[model samples]
Target chain A: MLNEKIICAGFGGQGVMLMGQLISYAGMLEGKEVSWLPSYGPEMRGGTANCSVMVSERPIGSPVISDDATTAIIMNLPSLDKFEVDVATGGNIIINSSLIERKTKRDDLKAYYVPANDIAVELGNARVANMIMLGAYLELTKVVSVESVMTALKKIFGESKAHLMKINEDALAKGSESIKAQ
Target chain B: MAKVLMKGNEAIGAAAIKAGCRYFFGYPITPQNELPEYMSREMPKVGGVFLQAESEIAAINMVYGAAGAGARVMTSSSSPGIALKQEGITYIAGAELPCVIVNIVRGGPGLGGIQPSQSDYNQVTRGGGNGDYKLLVYAPANLQEMVDLMQEAFDAADFYRNPVMMVGDGMIGQMMEPIEFKDSVSRFDLPEKDWATTGTKGQRKPNIINSLALDPAELEKHNHKLQKKYDAMKENEVRYETYNMENAEVVIVAYGTTSRIVRNAINDLKEQSINVGLIRPITLWPFPEKAFDEVPAACKSLLSVEMSMGQMVDDIKIASNGRWPVSFYGRVGGMIPTPEAVMGKVKELIGGEK
Candidate 1:
């Protein structure tokens, strides 16, 4: 793909912004042009928080993604409710089945559901749910390689948090594997 | 130089340091808070001064003092905060002091939402402060350009001995993108600050840096000198870019983030067999009037896209000089116009051209 516009959205504490940043950083690692823009407002934690991530062979134009999202990774019920229609025709939608009880009603695009929070809890860190969703998105799209994401994580966390790399890698593997089995 | 991903605000802060700017004074505001935060941490490490002033008024005066002392200085604020600094900016300009001011603009008529907006176009381009002064304004469209222009802003300030404004909106301040810093340091041959107020040291006559002149004739002379410099800047510093204008039927004029959206619109219009082009002004003050002269002869109409209520369209019309019909499309109050909307507007303007 020459370009991909993805919206990662959930409640504030779900690491929606971090997931977007990871995707952007991974795109940078692969020597592609990337942009990550987080929605900023008066909302605090547990409120609706989302970020727009764009990876392209050419430089990104607008960081604000009102619509025309090539992929939508929604982690909660509200996010799925909000952004399901924004997905472009024939685009892909990934839903976190652990928190979202409803399914996307659109028939034009592919939909994949992962119990991301449950999978992260299984990996002993529920905070990594966004990482799980990121892995699933990567597996489905192959926009950036998993190896690039790993390198990006190392750069992000650095030496002080090096010990947590294993669990993140495991979470990524489990998420990608679950999608493959489906 | 290695490319690293950085937020636009943080990259500008780092670029200022790279350009040898060691004195930063500013009051904090939303959407641009990261700039001051980055300067707070980085300035002290470089033996530089970073003061969080009591207010934007006090901050700009501090810049005046530092710049008068021959120090490369900078101050940044958002919309309302920048409004408070206008008086001081006018004073600095009158004194012919070199300083860099950054305005990461947010929506405004008053304390508008902290989201990005290009509504400050008129305020910055036409002197926001009182008097007949001009600030060399640069509007960068992306992170790399932001970094490059932040460095160039300091050079331009010193080269002209005037305040240079780097105008960007909230999206440019908040978005993260990869940027590569220039390998070589800036090499502009700036005039020596022999007239700087550095206590005189009893070796020569004491230098006085004041904008106040009791005699109107003297003030007029000073204003005329400033006007001459501004004319020279208009001739030498106008910057812009043209995209796909070779055989375009409609031309879109925009700058900063709005230009990016226009580029996307151009791409989509091309796919539909609509030959559209873009003229992106990089310098708001110099305004790039010459770019309109280069608009293809095949172009039938001109369209200006902005995040403001068509502030730049007037300039586009003036530049095009009625050679073609001019149209404008804009969204204000922190709302960003989408590519589809811009393309729709372009199609409307160039009816049946496809």
Candidate 2:
């Protein structure tokens, strides 16, 4: 069982939901039970959108979650404010420093403010910021193998955007390196 | 044999491709829009046709046209958009076309809200369009069911040469869960499509797919034929699930996402030694009345929960047949009642009644 609950939240168009999908896919590829549930509605575009990705060795009981989140990736200020309190003690938070500036407020949980956007920009695509965060989370939590993430990304985007795989892989490597330096 | 976690909408889209569903026509609607977006991208890869129809009506008509041509076709929409497709649905049923229609329902009597709701129960089960026909409606509660039922729906529709529907609320369509497909099931390998309007080149005859029968007697015969098909579907295709009902005093009857919420309520009640269970109907049309017979023998009362105001409750009442006192507790217009709220109702129903 993966035995973890991960949430990624941000504005609708920020690829927050897709990041959750990637993690969920990677988890599934690793032979774990997983679910990805998005906060869906008209609000998904502008107001707020978040996805809950749960991976366990056993069949998941509820696709919906109430607390018990062990990992969070907040791409916006509102996402951080909303989910920070819910992060389990000794959990981890990966914040996209380009979009969010808040310092970690909780001493119990470890927080990493990765410059995901700047890394994505340096990689020549701001849209890949979500991939950067995913890469950082993978290195920090080791929830899934970097190989699986790479395979899942290729499986999802290879046919559509042929060039994105290399650019995004670079962004992911950058994310992993930044975390390693810390 | 690798599993992939995908949203309900994306899974449905992928399953359709895996099932050899080559023609897809749909318009954009919140909650379920991702389905079309997904189809748009994946269809081409599988040599399938994906079209963003101008409107729900157009999309459904395209389904009717494609189905008439011996093609496995599908169209999806939300509640309000589904209402627009009702006219086409009736035509499809009257024509006895084999196609799949997906309704990722949202709250509605009118343009309601975009939140998840099961308000389309009556419209879907009873044939939302103007007719005395019934669609073989399959209701999926989770993402795995969503994929498996879609494949079954396509098969069922083709088996009986009737229009089948995979009906679910927005939550079931939008949520994601782990799923895997064993081998590709091609729609092209189905029993010969003898009833299609394929070009007649020295063939037996040109099949004319139309709902109009001018003679009243002829129309009556057609209606009777459709009724017989509906009856057969009701007998063989009705599906449901029962959990911990042997010694239950209260049975929660719910479907789609509401059933999951009720399961949570049942768990909470079980902790306090309250005997509660659930009967989740997987097919809305068949209505799984036989399950209720077992429920009445054990449970004294029932709680019908849904995202609509007493829609499925009516079906529960009919199924229960006044044998056990039945009560309704639900939310409407996309307002999902929390488990705590639902548990409150369960406690009241158990406590308020002697």
Candidate 3:
């Protein structure tokens, strides 16, 4: 853990919360202190959803508030509208360009708009857009290694989803490669 | 040696595992649902038992059952749900069964708002259930203490042969905090037991954990024994924190989250040249009256701030012994008073007319 707090947000069913959990789980796998907190209650249904994942080398005091977020992942316009202001100065924002039309306007912050949905679709799974976005985050933020993320994916999906793991991995590679291009 | 950032609920769940607790029974309630949800997934991995009971009542009873088995058993709930567990809690105490209960308190007189509140201080410290029984209540202020106290609660429960409670408000449960687990302080060396109802095949006799002493004499003796435990707890376990009180004129007494808020109030009071300090009770039941006794002669009054309508204020008054005038300020339900709001009261007491 390196005191990195990422707030992942998007509309419901976009796997916004799942993306956050994966990052948290990955941090945990790396023996880092990590917390994942999802927005609560009925708002989880058809409303905008957000989850906060904080990874630190030290013990975290509060998972919810961070003026030091090193990275943020926004899947849609609603997410960008909601959390773009809170991204720390100099933090990176990984945006899904397919949905969020307006760009982040911060001079101090770095923004990369990846067509995550398009890439996920090209990989034959729109649901994996969250993974692609996470891949973009991992690449741009260098929060975790691709190998570590693959290990986490294996643990999370387990032996049963072994087949779908390849496509997800491919999508993640594409996202990473795109970030390298940028 | 490694640290993991985790929700307060998740931290407690993980701590329970580290503490050698193998049985968990609980019902889901706001601000604390993550505890059970995390246990549901993690318990199986550790070969532990996690059951989502039908309600708070049943959850506590399941705790009773597992505790009687002489295994480390635990349960958790929010305010209203904890209220429902009161009856079973009393029974657990009366039976002297060792177990740990966690109250991730939310604001409530009824189905209060899901936001965190320290309103449950009195109920937890004074025995949330009925009877003369007492719980070794450990009130943790942050996530690190949350994990540490969970382990303490289990050890204390077994040590005293009574139920112990870990009391924390919504903030401690929901806040993300950095915490570390040390192997030295993490594991337990609890006594080996033949009291568990594992199997009767080669057992000397069946062990039954029951509070129903049909004979009046036996019941009275049992009650007396429990009283001795409570008395001993009062003497040995009262926990508190005193801040900037060497020459303080006003003593602000608070507990749990309210105490943290009062710390801010004290800072603001100091900036105005008001000599004020704080005495925060970390263990609400064994209310740390000892610290209050050390209040400087210049202290003319004590203030009690809570999230409930002065529930803890009543205790402060009793502890003060009418020495200094005790005052009360509070916010009810799920509404937490801002530090500014508490400062207003502090100013009125310390700066304005007493």
Candidate 4:
């Protein structure tokens, strides 16, 4: 019964594509149908980049996420402004409060503002900010397991970048705890 | 290898290597740029050669040269680059060389936007090349299909000794999906290259490859030869898939990413008890014309959905042959049509019940 249509958006350096890929890879490992499509072309370098991800028990259709998403993971101010409207009514939006600095404008959505950058700074790795936001998302939805995400992380990092996994795992836990504590 | 996540561009390279392709010549273009990057990185590891030609024209001519020497060679580019390669593409076809050409299409009648689009339908299927030539064109909707068809493309090219074009929009090049590279069956009994220009050991006739037939009747004979190969391909290599077609009132025809969006609409329409079926053409050149015959007699309308302003609709119309009233819905210039939008079209076609 786990069918989630999600959009993850942020500044290009904020690792939103990685966030989308991790979910798709984890869902694939769990034998769920998954697809990740990014906003490509001229804006990939410094512009706001976003990716749509679908993980479902049934076959996925149309990787483009225009509206009615089950979740929208927002990592920056512009991302929230753009994607907040895409979330389905009564769906969840995990906002990166450290950078976004505002609330979800939609009252129907259940918003969880995780201080992802601040949490990453505390966790001693700035790049894991996206993982913190992802962690907060997993805690709320539980669509895919944290362990599966870790396995997917290991695969993505491969042997060369294996050293970074520990910090990312810790960031995920802290981000998850932020939601669980509330 | 276990299934892993890969972008469409990278997976295409992987499949080519699996298919025993040894030479890749390409010029960089957005969306498909990653494919040449993958080939440059992976081709050498397999002891194959990868070249980034100075331009698309040079790249495709390089393909013609390598393919003439009996190597499974390929070249890739986006819309404008593919347009640049047209002259060389026609030469390869005229010379009857077997090679693979990939067009990861972007929007254009000119230098259009860089987004997902199917605007190059006419460009690839109709072909921009000169003379009587038809390249075997394949339009894969997803990454998995891209890989499978990419491998098959090589076999089909070598089988018929004709050029094969593998096409996908920008979305098919950029999207990430988990794909497994299975040992797909080759459709043709791949014959030996008795025609290749490999240097004879002074033991056989030295092969000379040229597209020129100066005499009018000689050129006509050559055209008939190429046309015969195309006719054989049309007879044997048409591929398509049908979904939810039983007793449906509206049958939508589409290909590639547009077909994926249409599937979503069909699923949603089922909940409202308004049945819609899909005929997804996997091969664009052959156009899967016979698929129209499968439409239920109860069908009220035939719809052609595309990411362009109605290019393939003509093919559908020709295929259906006035069996039912044909309609079209499209969004061009890199704009993609959503499922909600497609469903709205279906409602307009068959309103309020069944």
Chain B: TM-scores of all predictions: 0.98, 0.95, 0.94, 0.98
lDDT of 1 by residue, B1-354 (tens): 878989999998999999999999999898899999999999999999999999999999999999999999999999999999999999999999999999999998899889889999999999889888999999999989888877778988998899999998999999999989986666578788897898867899989999898899998999999999999899988888999897898999989999998898899888998889899999999899998887887687898898888898888888888899888899999889999899888878777545
Q: What is the lDDT, from 0 to 100, of the residue B115 in candidate 4?
A: 83
**Please, what are the lDDT tens digits per residue for candidate 3 over residues A57-172?**
86554455435567878888877877888888988888899887888977788889899888888888889998888888888777767777777678768899999888888878
Please list the C-alpha lDDT of all candidates, in the order they appear: 0.91, 0.84, 0.80, 0.90
Per-residue lDDT for A1-182 in model 4, tens only? 88899999999998999999999999999999999998886775668999999999988778887878999999888888888989889899998889877788899988888999998998888889999989999999988999999999998899999999999999889989999976
- In candidate 2, list every pair of residues with a backbone clash: A1-A56, A1-A57, A2-A56, A2-A57
Best by DockQ: 4
Q: How do all models score by TM-score?
A: 0.98, 0.85, 0.74, 0.98
**DockQ computed for model 2 against the true two-chain complex using alpha carbons:** 0.50
TM-score of chain A of each: 0.97, 0.94, 0.93, 0.97
Error of 3 at B92 (Å): 1.3
**Superposed Cα deviation of residue A130, candidate 1 (Å):** 1.3
Q: For model 2 chain B, give the 10-residue run with minimal summed lDDT.
A: B181-190
Q: Candidate 2's error at B151, in angstroms?
A: 2.7
Predicted candidate 4: what Cα RMSD to the true structure?
1.2
- Tell me which residue pairs clash in candidate 1: none
Looking at model 4, how many pairs of residues clash? 0
How far does residue A154 in candidate 4 sit from its true spot (Å)? 1.0
